[model samples]
Each structure stands twice: as structure tokens, then as C-alpha cells.
Target: MVREPSDRSSGPEEQEGVGEQDGFQRLWTPHRMAYIKGENKPSGPGRDDGCPFCEIPKGTDEDGLVIRRGTAVFAVLNLYPYNSGHLMVCPYRHVADYAELDDAEALELARFTQRALAALRKASGAHGFNVGMNLGTVAGAGIAAHLHQHVVPRWGGDTNFMPVIGRTKVLPQLLRDTRALLAESWPED
Candidate 1:
């Protein structure tokens, strides 16, 4: 038998013996919906096919959350970060693999990674770091069309039950603010 939902008032107190209150409080994060829905993720593997790494370099530093711009690479904050100061060093050229990078690109990418570590340490007093690349989708690269190396800053006991059990990471600062701080802390060449 098909039963129709009653047209009763939906308020918590107004509900008739339904939706019993639990002790848990909701930490509603509506912003995560965009990521969950894959809103800006690339539709195809081409540079012109909605690749964020290609598009990010075209905008101003502040708008793109870019910390430093080298000749062949740039450092930008991860839109969906694992930690507070997580950023990526990406080659300007939209190549999928690290082996595809030219000599200049590879050198600058390494230099930028070094600078990222220093800047993050100065800006946030990070105790440690998780730095590497997820080469492809199978390797856990979110945007596998472009080559980017992650520079995730870590502090002692940064991981907690929130991310383990609750499946949520609590970032204490905004991306823009973190960008500004890291940019200020970046070493001058």
C-alpha cells in the first residue's frame, strides 16, 4: 500500500511523536556540497576543457589564491585542503605527468616546493609536512589533467577523531587569509 506523508507542520516541537531528538548537534557545512557534487571538476582531460590549473594562472594572485608565481610554476592554495595551510606547486604548462615537464619547469617546481615548506613554517609554525604528488586519478589526484605537487603542512596531533570518525577537517582560517599570510612569508628571490 502507498502511504502519503501527512501535511503536518515540520517544526521539531510541532512534529507528532516523530523525529525524536538525539543528543548529537549538527555541524552543518553547506559549502562542502559543491565539492561533493563535483561542481568545478574537469569534464574532460584537455586544457581547454574546464581545467582549473590552466584557468587559475589567468587570474590575479588574490583571486586565484596564488602565493607565488615563478617563471614555469606557481604555488596556490588547495581549494579543498586536507589541512589549514595545504597548497600545491603546479607547472604553468598543463601536462598530466611529471616526466613531461621541461628542465626549467622541473627546476622551478622543486624550488617552489622548497619555498613552500619554508613559507609554511614561517607563516604557520607547522611542525611537519606531507609533500608529494598524486600522479593520476588512480593515485588520488583530484585534478589529474595537470601536474601538481601537494605541500600539506602538519602539526603535532593535527589528526583527530573529527577526520577519523566524524569525517570532517576543521580549518581554523580562511583560504584567502592563509594565502595572504603565506605570500607575506614567502622568501624573495
Candidate 2:
């Protein structure tokens, strides 16, 4: 295996690049982009988007595995889930931050979250979950353009050698099967 860089190579390699350091020199690297915005840029907009969360429908489809859809919110199966029944909730509007969500949109989001949790519980016997959002790029938002909440189901003893030793998460059920179960048991609000 290749070894990590030593102190000597790091210094000379940096200088040889014509001293061409960028403002976000330490922020992003080709190997791994730090999700966070750097000092040169503003922190976050926390605002709506022209091509943000609202664009989920353009790619998401029920037959392809969407679970539920509401007036202002929707839920879908996560292809890459932490467990068998991981899901995601997004608002029809593609805005970041809790502040921009109005009364109706906020209520819909909350209601849909509840529905997703209930369905996951019924489908996979999941009594607990880890639901959250990574607001900015630095916060681990893979798609920073659109903000959404992740509802990860958990069971006792679910953390096993697969994730730790193998560095892989294994789902017991297929994405389609999980989708069908959740779709059938979706709680109507």
C-alpha cells in the first residue's frame, strides 16, 4: 500500500506549484472535498432554490421507489441506507434552514416526517431512528443544493462486524421490498 506523504515532500511539492495557493487552499482537495465553505465565501444562504430540494420530483418516481407524496412534502427510500429502512423527507420547496419554512410548509414537513417514521416502524419493526439534516456542504450534505432530512432506522445489535470490520453496511431487504412495505403502510395525515 502507498504510504501517506512525509513532511519533506509536503513542503517542496507545495512550493513547486508556483506558490499558486488558492484562497480555499486548505478547504478543498481533489482527494476529498471538505463539505464546508471556506473563509473566502459566505457561510450559507438558508434560502429557497431555483434547482434545490424542489427538484426531487424530476428524478424521483413512485414505481422506481418513492414511498409517499404530500402537498408540501414527500418521502423516499434511500438507495444507500444505514439500515434496511432508511428514508428521506423533503419539502416541495427547495429552501435551506428552518427559518424560511412558513407555517404550512413546516407543518407539512413535520407531518410527513411522522408518517415516514410510522411507516418505517410498521414495515421494519423499527422503534427508533436518527433523523437530521446536514445544512451546509461542510455539514455533510452530499447534495448541498437541496436540503432534506434523513430518517435512519435502528435496531438493537444492528451495529455489527459488517460496518466496523468490513466497512460496509448491509441491508437485509431489497430497496424495492422496503419501498413496497413502506408504501403500503404509509400513514395518512
Candidate 3:
């Protein structure tokens, strides 16, 4: 089934050079410009020095993209999630190392991770998950000054050719919606 390209004059959006297109489909992700431009990245590691992990919890959960708040730790959506429901468990303290975490912070972090998985399972029907920490910048910690564990949900056939060949991730859900759903489903413990 060969579908011919429509005449460019049909609509302003279809005009040549108005937008880039692939033969099959398009994934326009303009919001990523902020990430690419490093818009909200912190200047330093200080607790009040603009680090996102440190500052995020201070705002309303919805605005901050936070899923749940614990005594010493919190769970929040990954601003630049690899998948739609990607989440991170982080300590409230501005400590960088996992070893730096006090017993309570460490325990709560673990609990949050568990709860995040449960919430995601209930909210999104996740088949599997990739949960771990990236210790430092060299090890893939986008925000290395704060200790955080990634909780990326996975499903069968989730990894497609776009990420492998085009270096692009296709997230089907909106971040705020994903956050709201997970927050609603988060265990009350």
C-alpha cells in the first residue's frame, strides 16, 4: 500500500520545510529543548543551591512531579524519563553517596523504591522494572550531587528501533499524567 505525499499547498503545516517528517510517522518532542539546553540544572551541590533533587520536594507534588513523600526520602518522576513511568527514589538530604545515607534515609529510600514499583504496576501494568542507582556523573547520574535510585518500568517489546538507531525515546504518556496516576496509586505506608 503506497500512500502518495499530499500536495504541499493543502495546508500550512504540510508546507515544505515547515516540519521534518519520516516516511512512516513523526515523534515531535519539542519539550526536550529545555533538557538539551540544561535549563533547570543546578549550579552547585548545596541543599539550597538549586539542585533539582533538593528543590523539587519543596513545591506542590504535582508541580514538582513528585509521586510520594516519605519521612526521609521521596519518589519523583524522572524529568527526562527514559520511559513514560520512569521514577527516582531520592533522599531528602543533599548527600551524594549511598554510603552517606543514614539508616533512616537508606531505609526510606528502599521503601520508596518498593512502593514506586507497586504504584507503577497498579497504574501502568508494568511487566518488569530496571531499578538501580547511578553513583556519579561518570557512572550516568544526570544529577550526581544527590543520591537517587532509578525505577524505570519496562514491558515486553518496549525497546524498539527508535532508541537503537535514531537515539530517540518514545514516551506515550505525559509526565504530569504519569505522576498523578502513580501518586494516586502509591501505597499509603
Candidate 4:
């Protein structure tokens, strides 16, 4: 004799604790709303339209997520980081192209990038780093109008199926917390 499937087994919702349990856990990150909403995006390349890089320096270091400040450049935590200690080294000038940087800015940019990596290593035990610049909008720069070099700290097994499958990056630490740690470990002078 043939039997029909039970009505209660129609879908996962009907099963006991089955709908909520797929053997995978989730980490809700509602704080990313500002980035998603483009809250601090520059209206134009000019500093007048409220460029984040320019405005950041005006605020307190902790409020700005700044880890270190140099003469011509500064290191700040990436608002939407690729990893826990992701940093962006940016020149104070609001120039879009790397070639536009003055010699002082250029030198400080490199110096800040190195310093950022060192601080990340000491503070977070980073095993590797991805440090580079995304030159333009077409090159994957989120803020193309302002030049910034990304220094993303990486560790073994840091990459997982989450980003590929869910289109989400899970950062274990908060930006402020990471900033404080890096700031504490920042190189003197």
C-alpha cells in the first residue's frame, strides 16, 4: 500500500526546532547600517563636501577611529573592514590620485602603512597583511575621490565560506576596540 506524506512534514517549519537549526550559526551585525547607507560618503572630491578623511582628523582620535597620526598622513580603522584590524593610511590632502601627493605626503603615507602593519602585528597577532591602494572607482575604491591605502591584516584560516556564501565579512572585534589596541601599540615617533 502507498502512503501520502504527513501534513505536519510539509516544510522545515513544521519540524521541531528544524527551521532555526541548520547546524550553522549567525552573527548579526546591524551596526553596518551607516556604511550601507553611505552616511559619511564625500559629496565630491573637494574637502568642502565633507570628505571622511578630512573630517576624521578634526575629531578626537578615538572618535575618529584613528590609530596614529603623522605629519602628513594618518592611520585609521576601515569603517567597513575586510578583517579585524583593517587600516587605511590616508594623506591629509584630499587629492584623488597618488601622483598628486607631495613628497612629504608620499613619504608619510608609506611610513604610516608600515607603522599600521607593525601595530596590527603587535596588537592583534596578525600573521599576514594585504597592503595596497585601489586607485579609482573602477578599481574597487569605495571612496574614489580621496586616496587611501588599505592595510588589511590576515591570519591563518581567516578566509572562510561565509563571505563567499553569504556575502558577509565577520569581524571579531569592534572598530573602536581595534583602534584602541592599535593606537596603544603604535610606534613612538
Top candidate, metric lDDT: 1
Cα-based lDDT for every prediction: 0.91, 0.69, 0.86, 0.85
Q: Is candidate 2 or candidate 4 better by TM-score?
A: 4
lDDT of model number 2:
0.69
- Model 3 misplaced regions, further than 4 Å: 1-26
lDDT of 4 by residue, 1-189 (tens): 333435334445435644533333455677888888888898887888889999999999999998888889999998888889888999888899999999989988988887888888899889999999999989988888999999998999888887878778877777888889899999886
Q: Specify the poorest-scoring 10-residue window by lDDT in model 2.
A: 24-33
User: Sort by lDDT, best first: what order?
Assistant: 1, 3, 4, 2
Cα lDDT tens digits for candidate 2, 29-139: 332223233321223453332343444466656554678888877787765577887888877776767677889988888888888888888878886899998887888
Compare the candidates by TM-score and give the number of the best one.
1
Please list all clashing residue pairs in model 3, or write none if there are none.
none
Candidate 4, superposed: residue stretches over 4 Å from native = 1-26
Higher-ranked by lDDT: 1 or 4: 1
RMSD of each: 5.0, 9.7, 3.8, 5.3
- How does candidate 3 fare on TM-score? 0.85
Per-residue lDDT tens digits of candidate 3, residues 1-189? 434575333334454567543244445678999998987777777776779898898899999999888889989999899888999998888999999998989888888898999999999999999999999889987778888899999998888888987788988888899988999999888
In model 1, which runs have C-alpha deviations exceeding 4 angstroms?
1-18
